[model samples]
Target: MVREILRVTNISCGCNKVMVTVEDGSNFIADAVIITMPLGILKANFIEFEPKLLDRKVTAISDLGVGNENKIALRFNNVSYPCLYGSRAFVYDLEKLSDEFAANFVML
Candidate 1:
């Protein structure tokens, strides 16, 4: 059965068994426990294990981080670049653009 888990604690990993205490104070045992929490949550130390996790494991988790970059590509119809300019791409400073200039884009 798939259950909604609020928290996990008292994890004990032995030769062939894995036991954990759920938020409701119920004990659950399984062959393995798959923790799919996000890196951010894992870094927060939400779960408390019976035997504290190894320093190397904690170090690895702390060393992990995520980054993202957003990009936008624009294509203008009925537009041509001068051969002397030799480029079809134009970069704009959005903050520098006036509201009127930005409004023209919404019409497209």
Candidate 2:
């Protein structure tokens, strides 16, 4: 347990613990985990989340005032919890991710 974690692919907060998956398909679970990657890395979107982050959070991290290229928003009016559509905004499905990836996770 003395090696460095590289190529983190996904991080999920399940039940009362955190689960981290690496590019090598290794899984690590813990009470809590900390990520110290730089802002640039975050903007690059090299990693993915089980419950994908909302569009707003994604925009904030990826924006960097680079323009609309970073914003990715898909809309579905026929679906429930329709927040924004056809805009440069991102929204997550509550029923899909549950508390694991709440839309307002950043607020917490």
Badly placed stretches (over 4 Å) of model 1 are 66-108
Mind giving the per-residue lDDT tens digits that candidate 1 earns over 12-31?
Answer: 78779888887779988888
lDDT by residue for model 2 (5-55), tens: 487888888699888888889988988887777676678877777678898
lDDT of candidates 1 onward, in order: 0.69, 0.70
Per-candidate RMSD vs. true structure? 13.2, 16.9
* TM-score quality measure for candidate 1: 0.53
CA deviation > 4 Å runs, candidate 2:
1-5, 65-108
Clashing pairs in 2: 55-90
